[model samples]
Target: MEIGLVGKPNVGKSTFFSAATRLEVEMASYPFTTIDANKGVGYIRNRCPHQDLEVECEPNNAPCINGTRMIPVKIIDVAGLVPEAHKGKGLGNQFLDDLRQASTLIHIVDASGSTNSEGEPCGKGEHDPRADVEFLTKEIDHWLKGILERNWDKVSRKLEVVGGNVEHAVYEQLSGLGVSEAMVVLAVRSADIQESPKNWSGDDLYRLAKAIRMKAKPMLISANKADLAGDDLMDSLMTLGDDIVIPTSAEYELALRKASESDIVEYMPGEDNFKVLRDDISDMQKSALDKIESHMKRYGGLGVQQTLEKAIYELLDMIVVYPVENEHSYTDKDGRILPDAHLLPRGSTAEDLAYAVHTDIGKGFIRAIDSRTDRVIGRDHELKDGDVIKIVSK
Candidate 1:
């Protein structure tokens, strides 16, 4: 699944991307630092594959190899959006097209309101971050509405043959928007469309548009620059009733990761603080690093790691399942233990997972054995997190 990182200009999109993937992109304190989309792999740490192996290690050091299983979720840092992005303003068509293929969007908001829509510094009291969210969401909804409006005549004609069901017509028209057939059915049902086209109001059209958007519309609010925003901002955000707001300091986290590589300070990305391993660094440098590190821990998480993972698993409801052969060794064809891990959608059955593994495995139509529990299950067995399954095919 691909997730697009989008927001108004200079809302730390590039910083979030850099921190999440550890790739260096041109991050400036200005708008449109990322004009083109930068794609990278962001990894989450699952329970160690060798955890059940009972290998011993020191505190803060696990015995398992630190290699991450790359599930290949494309993260696109698209160009910034302005108030009128839907109306061909501020690289309008380009930005929307970039996000057209994304399964979901992660809106990186400047909770501190340090920057304006143009990524310019404004007076402290003049910034309204909530307006940014409203504006961007409106643009997306309007853009989809425009697409539907343009094709309304053709779609309306098709409805006559399909029993005059506007929902079916709308789904047939919007199949290119990366919405799945099942999700389209849900969107149509939730839209409450009528049999007669004359009864459909502009509001109905808008609601239909919004539902299509929501099909791929799982968005996580990244309350960025939390260190600068303070507790009141976080408390205020929590009170707003958004379930997936994650406080993050992207810049500080990237710097800390850089520091770790240099061996100046031993720091984990999400840690509240760091341990100073060497005294050779200047006191001024150490103090600067310590301030950023401390800010990260108190507010929420250091980099975008915690935020991205929370968005993927908790907000998106995804689960990772390991497909392996050897129950004792937990190895794949290349003898690498749990080398291939598939992140499947929630409520995915064993048959669905079999298709993800390979068509042959799925076509054989057999059962699966949960290696962790040594329990055999049918093709329709529902999978949970961290499940290791051995497919028993014909």
Candidate 2:
């Protein structure tokens, strides 16, 4: 699954991306510093199952770092969103299109309220972060709505005469956005607009649009630049949703990672604290590290990790499974132990994992063995998180 970093300009989306992926991108104080989307492999931290089995795991594709499985995922840093972007302003269409494949969005909000509506520098608390959250959601809705509306006449007219489903028509319109027909159907049903396709009003279309956007592009607000934010600013943002707001200091995360690279500090990607390896650091650098430490102590690790975890596991309901040829040794054909850990939907079955491993194995149509229990199981057996399965193909 892909997670897209989105927000107004200068809200540190690039910094967040750099910290999370360590991909060097141009970060500037002005708007639209990222003209195109930058994609890199980020990771989700999972407790490696090898620790429970009392064995040392030598993973190949997904590495285990100190008992934490680093499962790689695609992360995107996209161009900032401006008002009326759906109206083709400020490379808006390009930015929105960059998010076409994203499973979820991390809205990098300037929690300190430092940037204005146009992404220009402003007072620390002048901008309402609540507005920042809503504006991005609305912009995405507008973008989807525009796509649906542009083809409405042809689609609705065809649906009327051909007796085609409204959801399918809308889904086809938004096919480029990776929207599913089931998602569109649910969105239309949730909006409670029972009108026929040809009779759908602009408001009806918008309601459907909003619902589709909510389902297809669900977002979590990464309360970014939290170092400069006050209590009131945080409280107001918390009021938006208890679990949705993750206070993040992208700048601090970047600093910690950079320090780790420089051998001045020993750090883990998602650890709450770090070890200062050397005492020769300058006083200014020491002060900055202190502030970052304070942020970590308060918020529980750099929020970048938590944000990605939430997007994949919580929002997307994905679970990790180890598909090995030899379940006993947890090795692939080449004898690489725990070589592949595939992320599948929570309810995915053993056969689903077989398909994820190889199409030929899935088509062979055979049972699977659960390594944990060493029990023979059918294709329909639902796989759980950290399940190690050996497919018995024909």
Full-model lDDT for every candidate: 0.71, 0.84
Give per-residue CA lDDT, model 1, range 1-394, as digits (tens). 7778889888889888877665322222212223344776665556654566543212111112233332334578877887788888887887898778777788888888778876677765358777677777778988888877877866676666555656566666676678766776787678887745545666777777788787766777787887677566667664555546777778787777777777777765545777877878898887887788567556645747777777678767898877776665676666656656677888988887888989998998678888888888898899987787888777
Clashing pairs for predicted structure model 1, backbone only: none
- Candidate 2 regions exceeding 4 Å error are 23-37, 241-243
lDDT (0-100) at residue 278 of candidate 2? 94
Model 2 — TM-score against the truth?
0.94
Instruction: Score candidate 1 by TM-score against the native.
Output: 0.88
| Highest-TM-score candidate | 2
Error of 1 at 156 (Å): 1.4
For model 2, which pairs clash?
none
Per-prediction TM-score to the true structure, in the order listed: 0.88, 0.94
Measured by lDDT, the strongest candidate is 2
